[model samples]
Target: MDSRLALAAVVCAIVLCATPAALAQTVQVWTRGGRAYSLTCYTRFEVVPFYRPPNATSLVVAAASPATPPALQPTESGVSTIAAVLLVMSCIIVVVKSRSRAKFEMIIGKNSNRKENIEELLDNYGSLAPKRYKYSQLKDMTGSFSEKLGEGGYGTVYKGTLPDGNPVAVKFLHDLTSNGEEFVNEVISIRRTSHINVVTLVGFCLGASKRALIYEYMPNGSLDKFIYAENSKITLGWDKLYEIATGIARGLEYLHRGCNTRIIHFDIKPHNILLDHDFVPKIADFGLAKLCNPKESYLSMAGMRGTIGFIAPEVFSRRFGVVSTKSDVYSYGMMLLEMVGGRKNLKSSVENPSEMYFPDWIYRCLADLGSLHTFDMEYETEEIARKMAVIGLWCIQVSPNSRPTMSKVLDMFEKSADELEIPPKHCFYSAIQ
Candidate 1:
């Protein structure tokens, strides 16, 4: 009976109190983490002091009249509002800065230090080998083009022997003059921006509208031949393809962003990539390469010089104006897709018109789950398929800004499928003359 009476009194007191905290003479708080927090209730018509309490005013009811609230509110409220505004503004500022920086950076964390931008350094540094060489010297080294090694969009590549009898690959210009200078520029610039993954430039010779770049000989030859050739697919491993793709991405990123001035390898393709003894990718053929200023892109070409299917959509005279680093991104995307599909995308079967354009096939495959059922599961083709889809999707973003940089492409290849989304296939550009 006594307990009941006390409970009733407490309930009545709680209901009648004008200020919950004032109703109770004492207050306390407890927290789960051993930290303390408190909240107080006050009357609307109180004195309202201009001070703020750190953590005070817990609600309590004791049937007493309320105390007035303070004139000033909690600093947290003001601070929170101000902080929110500032945070949003800060975020906006960061995004704008990143976009602008990317124009200069041109890609992910790579430094923009192109050698051509500092050609003076190259000229001043000078070549360890002789700058000037007689045409006869080059002819003698190449064995008078008697040893034909390979051919590419740039020109014919021949085998040569240095003074030490070390084998070298000498790329001779087929057109001479204008063509040779571009090759020289590419060789010199690439040499200046050399890394271990890059094929080293030994030296050059200029004569009678004739120029040739000398490079270390690759026993295995270009990657395209090894990966796409008949009876060669099974010889490749998932790990090896991953390495090659990653290396290519890094090389492209270096050209696009790692230099002080951005370089666009506008002529990226399998033929342009030479392979070392271990099948490592060495980017070659810089004749069509474009040098972009910090935050600025190069002018478009007078006519298309890159391989037909690999050329960027923006490069066409009709679709857009002003080709940018994103041009390379588009090409990379296509290359990745090609690598994934094997030679099926490129192998022109006269009997089958459906196989003419492979990226279109990729889009069709992506649209239907049944299309991937034909994949050869006996090999590591699945892993190759997974990476190719991801890297290709990243490269082919319609907007240059939407695409991932070469650095990002390498990072993407390194990550697992669980961390990535199934990539979307790019739309085909209307065939441009």
Candidate 2:
């Protein structure tokens, strides 16, 4: 009985500690035949002892229970998870913003360094350099960019008057990312040139975010307008055209030989040729010009630099030949043909598909007919046209070695049409092929 009573006490203590408050309250104890037993009684029971020993006692130890609370609610857990996610996202955003700001600041610093280098280059030239104007001064001169003269891929040209009342064409470059290389090229090349046919650079403007080149204004505008116009009021006769062609050749000759540093005008097209009031042709836009030693026959170019139609075969493909002054000669030849025909050298829409390439068509006409009688003209005009056509063909040979120098080109212009021989047909055939 003593041992049984001790076991009953131990079981009761365990039930009070281990069971929950609701179950502990329903614990029941009973004694039978001097033995004590404990049970966790609930609303339902499988069996009950009906026979009780004589003088047996029953004891029920009940504890008051409080309302049970859930271990963890769904809403509370969900809110905690969302807060943790938000905290992680915010940290990521801050890191990304900091990195972006650092990158932008680095780019600005590099651009600033480049601008300083350009300014130093200008300073080095001293009195020899073209006059420099402030960005504010340019705006005032251009009347807040009110009068736009023209716009191209690089920038816009505005007509402005200098303090001396001399009219100037201010070219405002829009692409700042180029780091002012084009501006530097134009200034370096044109400043060295002093000729009636080479357009003069009067001044320039450089700022933190702006760049411009000021040139002597040509009242007659570019050469393309006169050549390609349909019902144009400005009419240039064949003799005047021949004179213009000779003047351009002279300018090219000067650039190649007369200057201390040989300036190769890589881009020589109708659009780049400007005319004065008296209709005198001047070579303009030295942005693509390259300065080289007169002794160097070939130039090393990173990539093709001239317009598509005017780019020499060698400039685009190393398989043809090394790039040289002959490349400029090729461009001049294409432009000369355009001037003669009053149409582009390569045209998609033509009466005959075989005549699609103007140079080939002109070659065939010269070969078969011995004259450009397809277009009605006087004998003198026809003679001049035939001379220009033949000269153009000589300049645009597939192999650069075959093309004449600017000096030789000038000599060819001086000679009569009968003096010049026709270029090889195989040369023209290979060019078209």
Best by TM-score: 2
lDDT of 2 by residue, 1-433 (tens): 3444354455445444543432223332221112212232112111235567989898674643444344443333344333333333443344445556667889999887877877787788888789989999999998998999886545679999998999999987663444465466557667878888989988888676787889999999999898887632238888888888999999888888887677777778888889999989999875433321111112324555676678888887889899888999999999898888888888888989977888999999998999889967679888999899999999998899999998999989989998999998854523432
Give the lDDT of residue 380 in candidate 1: 54
Tens-place lDDT digits, model 1, residues 261-316:
57777767777777888888888765333321111122225655456667676676
Task: Give candidate 1's error at residue 340 in angstroms.
Answer: 1.5
How much RMSD separates candidate 1 from the native structure? Answer: 25.6
- Supply the TM-score for candidate 1: 0.62
**Every candidate's lDDT:** 0.61, 0.74
| Model 1 misplacement above 4 A | 1-123, 127-131, 174-187, 287-301, 344-356, 378-380, 424-426, 430-433
